[model samples]
Target: MSSTPAPAPAPAPAPVPAPAIADRPPPTFRQKAGFFAMIFGMFMAILDVQIVASSLADIQAGLSASIEEISWVQTSYLIAEVVMIPLSGTLARILSTRVLFSLAALGFTVMSFACSLATSLEAMILARSLQGFFAGAMIPSIFSTAYTMFPRRSMGKVSVVIGLVATMGPTIGPTLGGFITQALGWHWLFNINIIPGLIVAATVWSCIDIDQPEPAYLRGLDVSGLVALATALGTLNYVLEEGPRNDWFEDQTIFRLAVLSAASGCVFFWRAFTYRQPIVDLRAFSDRNFALGCFFSFVVGIGLFGSVYMTPLFLAQVRDYNALDIGIIMMVTGAFQFSVAPLVGTLSGRMDLRLMLAFGFSLFCFALYLNSFLTAESSYWEFFVPQAVRGVSLMFCFVPVNRLALGTLAPDKLKNGAGLYNLMRNLGGALGLAVINTLLVERGAHHLSYLSENLTLSRPEVQAYIDRLAERLGDSLAGGVAGDPELAAMKLLFQLAQREALVMSFNDCLLLIGLTFGAALIVMPLVKKPRD
Candidate 1:
């Protein structure tokens, strides 16, 4: 009778809990060194993107490149880098982080040295393209490694380090370039990376062992998808970079490239969804947070690179400040960014991330609004407050943006997600620069025409202003020039009008960017709170 009694069902198996933050082992010393080395390598890569920007004139003169051609130095790097960024995820899975990053660092180093030695514009462009392609791998690798290597509790500190470098590299780029060009020469801009690049390559190769190479993925390599992706991004970057300069669709080359980019992009997306193992894993976007996070990244890029592009340009054009002077003024943003990072790191841990994002974006918007008030006479002190605000706000924006975007992704998805995330920021910057350039040209002309229409010789104030200018120039005029005082005064008046119009255009651009951040704040509530 006892044997006939039904056996009690076994208790349901206890749920297997995830490893706790404390339970997870801390990063080994080698991992720490390797991560930092990758960070530095990323800094060098991103830094190079803008390093030659302030010193482009010097590079132009050194290489005897025409103004139109000189632009390609930067453009080539951007195009090549954009193509490489998304593809890096697939490359990493095949080659592993150790081989991919070390090779990239080494290749980047070699290309940098080649760039330093380039005597012709063609050679320089080739070297820079290779350099940028190599550099692109380093950026996403740092991001992927950060999420995968560390415990959730440590993300705050990791975010600060990565965010500071991601931002500071570009923020301080013009400053460092100006200083280097003034002190040594333009060649040293590339030369400075040699020792550091070698060290990064050596250190990463020796220390990094995060993921083993998935050789199986190589068997299913999406070559067609890779080509399609490259073509789409490459052509798209070209169109954005050259569209404003060439009158958008008015230019035959831009129009053709735009069509090609659209076609290729369609194919790339098609392959992405249909392929067994696509070059990029598009499934990451299925996560609501990741999708929104990318849009935020794109908008943040507009503010970050857009501000960096505009400020120095304003200082140079309106104030007649030299490269060194502009660099000094720009230093305020970098200084505040560096100083506030630790505070942000601490606050990130204690506060709600979504709230932190709102605060950061709000302050950034405020800073941009301040910048929208800039006049032609505005100088260092005028820029100081806005730059400081922007610097602090950026720390807030970047930290939260990084966490919110990549935090919820599974460890397996982090690599691809990071690539897509970074790609949006870069694309945003490219698009922002194009729009800013177009606005400057159109808006500047509009303001100039309006001013010209208002100021006529018939107006008493205009006559009086011309009279004073003529009188001032009378003493400086000699011989035939003396009879043309009125003409000289007219020329000077035109110059003044042009300067004021350009400043107004800059103000308009700043206002638009500020409004963009405000818009971003409205969407913050949609991001799901990330799991710890």
Candidate 2:
């Protein structure tokens, strides 16, 4: 009967309340120093993604690589980076932030040096792949640290710094690359990382103290899941990057990789859901805001990378601008992006993030719409307003989208969620580029064919155009003599038609990219307004 005295069972233990924004301690100097260093490392990582883009020709010539082989310089990096991005979450947990980030920075630096010394295409590809794997680890770790290290109130400023770095790195990449390649050489592209990389590694290793290494996580490594993930992502990236160039499934290699990617992807997903400790925790998607945020990130990626890719290309192919000229023209976007950072940081605190995101995406769509009017005669001034609008819009989009995606994740979930979030953006960029390339080729051919069909010699306009061109050619020739003036005129006419068709295709691609942002707008309301 005295057992009644033991009653009430010591009422269930109350859960510990999370620290309030005000209650949380400010980041110490060490944390701040470590964070900035990590941010620098992240910039290097992302910048390298496109630094080689503008200077691919130089690398090609340097290594005596064929047109097809030289592309692997970029492709190998992208494929390897994609595989490591999602896997970084697990690695970070097992190794701890300090150890993982330091190792990544050191490894990335060493690989950069190796790349600079590469004497063959094979060596460059191997070095670049290893470099990308290390680079991928640095990127997500910065994102996760930003969320976990700072308090809620400080996120506005923290987001601006991280957002500026993330978006600016890629935006200004080609510009920096072109300058470096033109003034120095392509080898400097990799060489530039050595000094900065060493500093970052040393600083981060000494200063970072975010969390302890979970040796238990290493014990539950999920080896099968890891292999499946690597296979799935690596094959998927290769297929996406090479598919457009290889005529998609028409190439046997692409087709086989596509199948392998699908099968490995299925295995990866199955392991993620059933395994006790998944390599990438799929449960993050169960958060409605995170899911919607990732979609926004994907669309933003299409805008961010697609524009960077297309603008330089149009200038190179249509306007015949060299790397330096294109870099000069591209400076507008980077300049505006820098100017808008402070304003975005201020607005992030006062404005409803959803509204800010809407405004940002609206500007992005408007900018793309402006670009759809591209002509072969278009020059820097023609691109100025659109690029500026895009730059401003990206700052707006990046800050809010990043906050909305990872801001609400629990500390325990932030690392995995950040990895997944970054993976989506990169995937979007890869897929967007593939689709853009395919569209450019197919649409260019269709337009060219149509123009040819309508410009037959039987047409009165065609004959008149030919006669005028012949007369001009004859007048321009030395001693007023021309060899088969009509034949020369025909050749000139075909060249003009080809140029017009290519411009039209560029216009089509820009319009489609704009429509993608428009579609993203439709889904904006599904994102729940974040809690105050």
Candidate 3:
């Protein structure tokens, strides 16, 4: 240091600074509030779609809608949803996600109020169409915004939240709708939405924040693609919604829709490949995982929605269980899902997701198989056990399988992937409902015919029944207790037999779901491993 101070000890080289980790913005108290509020909107919207499901009789009477017109209440909403799902991303880009979410909530609320006040079937239909348009925005926007708000590390947690909301809709919808319809009337189903929806809308508007709007150097709208997609979706939906009632292609309009639907679907896929920006990004399917994800989502949607639809119908109509009983049974299943979903999400990183999903499907299939044996005599306890078990299976499949589905996908593909996943779910559900309803009708007719023929009044046993009826009526074979106990007994017998036949039909249909589930087991091996 004395030798010219050793050049000041060679001055310590400037210490290199530690690299800074990108601090993820904290999930603000407001964002958190908004997230749950939007969830409330989602639950309300879903409940609206289904709650009225149990109150169709009352809705028709109140609005004076014919059965065909009554169907539009559900069909219009479903069609509007399908049409808007693919458009959600484009619309999001066009409008602020937060504003869109708020407007969606607002639109839904206003429409609900309007639908409540609708004086005629025509008015109700129009209100519902607008309601459909509004509601179509809620889910896709929520899903899109969720990806933006939550980091990758927190997705599992988010999934749990979304899953709970998803499961609860079916659980509480019919129960709430039934209580309100019984206590108040069908208009209350729509009216009840007003307060909750407005509250949700206000909360979301206050809390959800999006960046300032960018200039709209908008992408082309892909008009042809939109038309084709709409055609395919609309036609297919019509067929699905109407097929069971119209008896498939036997109806002229249905036949036309079937052809148009097929043609449009084929053309849409063909056009998609040729277009720069397709309505649906067909290239999403290029990712092996995403494509399979779509498949799984669709099939699972069928399982999920079909089971939800069938179980309640069987309980209320076939088994003669009340709305509360059906809700309780659904709650049992939903509770199981709530409990198990997080565990699956937690274990996903350690486990092979394909295996988990396979196991889930296997469990669901087993549950359905158990359910397949349902009869008019089956109790809710018998039903609840299997559904609860199915809940565990759905938990395994829904979250972990989703983890694998998107694990390999890039961020860029998320919007399309999510929307497609949702759309496929609804489509699968529509298909499942149509198939099951048709099967229910056909099976009922076939089985009823077979049973009725075998157990017909033509037998001596039936003659004895007639003789007994004549004695019970306190008029005898002298005039046969209505001058023809044979005809009266046969009429009474047919009525009784038809009810029994319908009961059998519904049970047989439930069993058929089990058969479909068994087929899913074979497809399990087709699943791929998550990317390392």
Query: What digit string (tens of lDDT, one per residue) describes model 3 on residues 151-186?
Result: 556666776677667656765677778878888988
Clashes of 2: 0
lDDT measured at residue 263 in model 3 versus the true structure, 0 to 100: 97
Q: TM-scores of the models, in the given order?
A: 0.95, 0.95, 0.87
Tell me which residue pairs clash in candidate 1: none
Task: Rank candidates by lDDT, best first.
Answer: 1, 2, 3
Error of 2 at 493 (Å): 0.6
Judged by whole-model lDDT over C-alpha atoms, candidate 3 comes out at 0.73
Which ten residues in a row are the worst by lDDT in model 2?
8-17
Error of 1 at 222 (Å): 1.4
lDDT of 2 at 151: 77
lDDT score for residue 33 of model 2:
98
Give candidate 1's whole-model lDDT: 0.90
lDDT of 2: 0.90
Ranking 1 against 2 by lDDT, winner:
1
How well is each residue in 1-532 modelled by candidate 2, as lDDT tens digits? 2333342322121112245443567899999999999999999999999999988889999999999899999999999999999988888877888999999999999999999999999999999999999999999999888876787788889999998888988888988998999899999999999999999999999999887776656655678989999999999999999999999999999999999999999999999998767889989999999999999999988888899999999999999998888988898998999899999999999999999999999999999999899888999899999999999999999999999998777677777888999999999999999999999999999999999999899999999999997987874554433677887788878989999999999999999999999889998989888776
